[model samples]
Target chain A: MRIAELSRRSATSIPSIKYYLREGLIPGGRTTGRNQADYDEAHVRRLRLIRALVDVGGLSIAAVRDVLAAVDNPDLPGHDLLGIAHHAVSPTPARRDPDDPRWQAAREEVVTLIGERGWLVSPCSPALDVAADAIAAMRALDQADLLSSLPTYVEAVERMAAWEVAAVLARGEPARMVEGLVTGTILGEILIGALRRLAQEAESARLQGLTAPE
Target chain B: MRIAELSRRSATSIPSIKYYLREGLIPGGRTTGRNQADYDEAHVRRLRLIRALVDVGGLSIAAVRDVLAAVDNPDLPGHDLLGIAHHAVSPTPARRDPDDPRWQAAREEVVTLIGERGWLVSPCSPALDVAADAIAAMRALDQADLLSSLPTYVEAVERMAAWEVAAVLARGEPARMVEGLVTGTILGEILIGALRRLAQEAESARLQGLTAPE
Candidate 1:
């Protein structure tokens, strides 16, 4: 089909389609004449997938390419796609300030940790790293805030990490890892609902002068 | 005795103190002598409060300034720093795209609905409006990757919205809002863990050829 037809069908623009082809994000269509080219189902599917990952999932072009390549490779597990999707959809990591020593230290740790996990973290997320660094730097001045509440915050992150680790370990279907990751995304929201309600009940109890831990 | 003393006492560096002053993030120090400025107990307390909101509470400098101003104004809720803090620390709303008609439509609905529900959503979140618009644009795509998954995504965002609402209702002290917002920020992560575990169990039971659901 023509570029405009494909664009309307795929929800991508004509120029974007040409760019994707040029970038090899999608394969070039067969040349039928000087200006005409033929695109098939594969091209359509690929374009749609690209849009979903980039436009919907907020993945960068590079990340989408890497993920699609993995998805197309038969040897790759579906879990890899989930990992990429998670990386894309997760909060953009804090950036690191170039002059900040604390940012430098945190960057090293985050890079090491993410690499060791063998997950597809974006190399471009220096912003999230620096944001975290700014956060860390502020702690020294605001020790009161950290000291007063950090045990709770740490406890919370730790609990979440434990829950994640535990969930990853529980498997059955050969695609358990894939299911686990997808389910994790969905169930994560539900658990927040549960926690919020629980916390609210605890707080209301405390406000009414009821005796129980809030 | 001077800015340096206040700095030493608060664990803030002289540079950060200066930055805060220059940015008008924190109030200026009272003049002492030819080359110094003096601050007292109130300054110390106010600075501590500012640090708490910016650091642990994760508010931007502008947002922090606005909230602090509200705290000082008699026309606002004088005793409800905690509730005010909730708005201060809420994530920057998603951006809306001006070029996209579908997105513009979605944001209009979001604005009307938020007002109808009486939620004090900020009108300044052009970014959030765009994001919500982008998400709406994706929904309009009608492809499987997006269309099939949107119900779940909406479920997730709605769940997040519920957490926001519940956290406000659940607080005994105003500080709970900060704690709850921080806690809720990771609520998605928590849900991810729980859902993975639960889905795995369900799948495992099926693999074991267990009893069918009634």
Candidate 2:
């Protein structure tokens, strides 16, 4: 196969594939002539992954590069691969106001929730900061009563994570497992957020006696 | 209360409060003596909501204004309010290539899922497009097998939205109910995303026999 075939197969543009090769986002094809290089199935696969991260996951090229590096790391344990991929795709946490009483209260709430659930989250996990920041913001806005549903939320996501991990693990091969984990984690968040919005709309309509969509 | 009191009560700075007033994100206070005006608890409340949307929800000032409009629409039924607020805060949907067969397949899958679940989602809901786009992206990346878990994901979010709607409705007042919906919808998405990340990490570590954090 050639770059053109790879492009057609991956649904990526040829110039974009060239740019990825120049940027080391994907390995170069084997040289066959002065002006031609022969690509293979691996090139096609890598191009697709890069496109997915950029177009769907909205990751920057550098972040996609980093995610690819993690994906290619043969020695990286499966457990740690998720953390790296998550950090690559997750939003940068907002600047923290450590002295804000509301922030302190929110952090305490998150720590307490994790403890009660007996989950094995690292004390310094960035997700902890992300969760606490959202909590602190909610508290600042005087939405404390809404936080009462924290237990319900926890239970829901717990079930979701279980199913997600089990599904990914079912892929068997270590390479597929890691790819599944990254794709599942990033794309899965978008899927869940979108689905939740639809469900909320339906639930609101049901409670308000609105007619279903035709 | 005056501007300074509004600042202190809402945890927003005086300049920010002035900016909000200038932007009409909040209503003007009653004018008093030269360079003086009287603010009140409503001012404080609006300021907090503005900050939450801007800071935590990552909404632009214009989006925040639109959300505020939906929030203040007394005649708008609660069912319609969710749609407006969701559209206001959601990411602009990408340009669609209607002829793309993969996208068409993904859209059909979504419509079928909605019908099977008997969810009253509007056919024109932006969320339907969002869900379909995500699914199409997954398919393009050769991760279609992951779609098998869609039922589990849908079920989990159904439970979450049910609890969330019930919690918001319990607030009683129409104003409070609308406020709860907006806050819950925006901030709740953040909370759920963060919690899901944390849960994935915990699940990954548990399955790998990794030790819990002290």
Candidate 3:
């Protein structure tokens, strides 16, 4: 296969493919002639993964690069690879004032939630920051009731996370396991976010006594 | 109160507050004199809401404008206001080819999931598209098993959505209800995503027989 076929198969523009190649997001194809290059199945797969991460997962180019590097590194432990991928995919939160009362309260709530759930998360995990930031945002907006159902949400995510870790660990190949973890971590968020919206709509309709129009 | 006060109180920079005013994402304060305007408590609250939506919710400026307009409209029903907010905050997905077998299959899966859960979502809901697009992405990445836990995730979100809707309805004022819904819908996703990651970390550590470093 050539670059043209790669573009056609991946549904990516030729210019975009070239840009990705230049950015080293996708490896260079084999040089078959002075200007012609031959791509293979690996290129196709790589292109698709890049598209999935960027287009659907909303990862930045730099983040994508880091995630790919983690995926390609054979020496990186599976859990550590997941950590890198997680850090890459999640946006860096704006720094919160450590002394703000709302932030302090939210941080305490997060710590309490962890203790109550008995989750073995590190105190330094970025996820705690993400959750606490959200909690502070809710408080600023005066919508504290949103956090009232924290326990239920925790239960739900615990079960899903257990399943995800098991699925990732079940893969025999380290490379495949890393790839699966990356994809699952990023795409799973998209899937869950979308599903939650749909559920809200459905629940809204039911509460309003509205039927889905056929 | 002036622009500086609004900025100081909201913890946003003067230039950013001016930018928001120029962009009409926030209503201008009353013009009391030349090169001066008197902002009030309402302005402070609105600025906070805008920051929460943009900073935490990751909504675009245009989406924020639309959501604010929906919130300001007095005649819009509370539920309808929420609908508008949901539509605005969620990015419009790139159109997928209807003929793509994977997309078609994913669409069917979305419909089937809704039906299985007895959800009352309309066929035209944008959330259906969002969910289907995510499913297609998962399939493209060859991580289709990620969707296998869809049932559990659905159960969780359904309960959360119900709680969210009930909380919104509990607000007596229409404006307050709309604000609460918008904040919950957007910030709630951030909170859940963070919590899910934290849960994954905990589960991974437990499964791997590792303890979090103190």
Output the number of the TM-score-best candidate: 2
TM-score quality measure for candidate 1: 0.55
Model 3, residue A62: distance off in Å is: 6.3
lDDT string for model 3 (A1-214, tens) is 9888999888789999999999989989889899899999888778776776787557889888887887788787777776776676677666778788888889889989888878887777788888888899788777887777788788889989988888888875654565666678777777888888888887777887877566
Estimate, for each residue in A1-214, the C-alpha lDDT of model 1 and write its tens digit.
8777788787788999999988889888889999899887677767776776665555677876776666566665444444444544555344435577765664565455434433233455422353344334434333223223222332343334344434543442223333334334433333333333333333333443444223
DockQ per model, Cα: 0.09, 0.69, 0.59
Looking at candidate 1, what is the lDDT of residue A102? Answer: 64
Give one digit per residue, the lDDT tens place, for model 2 in B52-120: 677655688888877788788788777776677667667756576768998889988998997799888
Which candidate would rank higher by lDDT, 1 or 3?
A: 3
lDDT of 3 by residue, B5-84 (tens): 88889888999998998998778889999999999988887887787678656788987887788778888766677687
TM-score for each of the candidates: 0.55, 0.89, 0.79
Which parts of model 3 have CA positions greater than 4 angstroms off? Answer: A1-76, A94-101, A212-214, B1-76, B94-101
Candidates 2 and 3 compared by DockQ, better number: 2
Task: Give candidate 2 misplaced runs (Cα > 4 Å).
Answer: A57-66, A98-101, B19-25, B53-73
Output the TM-score of candidate 3: 0.79
Docking class of 3: medium
The collision pairs in model 3 are none
